[model samples]
Target: MQSAIETARKQLPKIRIELVDCYTGSAAQALIALTAARAVKLGDNLNQIIPKVNKVIPEAEITLVLDTLKYLERGGRAPKIGAWATSLLKIKPVVTNRMGHAHFLGMARSRTQGIERMIRTMRGKIGLNRVSAIIIHSELETEAKELEHRLRSEFNCNETYVTEISAVVAVHLGPGAIGIAFLPS
Candidate 1:
């Protein structure tokens, strides 16, 4: 997985693949594109985020990515705060690596709602005024398309894409799961 990410980073200098190193249920696929690089006269925050993965498993890394809370609950990884919040606040968090560890970016509600929440965060953090999009899903093509459409429309993006969550992530997120990735203007 790390090697593939390195290759993608090199080929798409602007793109970086950041695998979700958290608990999930996406165990169907074994290959996932971490990022798609873009040409740039200057590097942006999203570009800055394209560092190579620091670690790799001895056997392999799963392709699809799944939601975390459920797996965390089953595995006793995440605490009651995130689980309780999921039910009480309907918060679906975007998981990201923090200093080689998985941390919750923020809370979101539904799938599209979560993507919308991430869009807001991406706009503020990366200033994605003009950029393409990608949607990673879990056997949910219809939802993925709708999500892509919404993202394209709301962000005025040139491209919106989707991919199934990797086997690693799906093992945690369960069946119905999805996510979106993109860069800045």
Candidate 2:
């Protein structure tokens, strides 16, 4: 992406090229890009759009509720001891992107609770009725739709998007992994 942006910059010296790392969250990345697109549509120049995009990128949040820890552990993202403990206790881990990395927030005894906890955390950060959200899942359309419904009902957002997780993301998250990324409006 950086190379592509650099090429565009060379072709259009009048336009500014800015890169916002979404910390590996596709949904969050989408939100950042969306912010830039909106700014462009509003006729904001590179200088104006840069600050807007930068502010939104950090404000963007992604909460992932993993169905299992095996994939994360296999990918060397989870500590062996933590994975073993969660597995033994039948706990589902809820993770969030923080400072360009995934951070463990807490665990839930059930998937339902885990999702609710994630929603609550997002609500605290973004507040209700003032967010735009995207839901992504790996081979979990039903789960993804349910989450989208919750976001619409809870956040009252008109710009909610539902999408399948990309193959690259799927390799690490595995099936049954669901996440939501949102930006406060």
Best by lDDT: 2
**Each model's lDDT:** 0.53, 0.84
lDDT tens digits, residues 60-115, model 2?
88898887787788899888887788778888899999648778889988888989
Q: For residue 26, what is the lDDT in candidate 2?
A: 84
- Note the clash tally of each candidate: 30, 0
TM-score of model 1 (CA atoms): 0.53
Candidate 2 runs further than 4 Å off? 1-16, 22-24
lDDT of 2: 0.84
- How well is each residue in 6-75 modelled by candidate 1, as lDDT tens digits? 8888898965546654222222111112321231224434435333211211111122123447666666
Top-scoring candidate (TM-score): 2
- Residue 15, model 1: Cα distance from true site in angstroms: 23
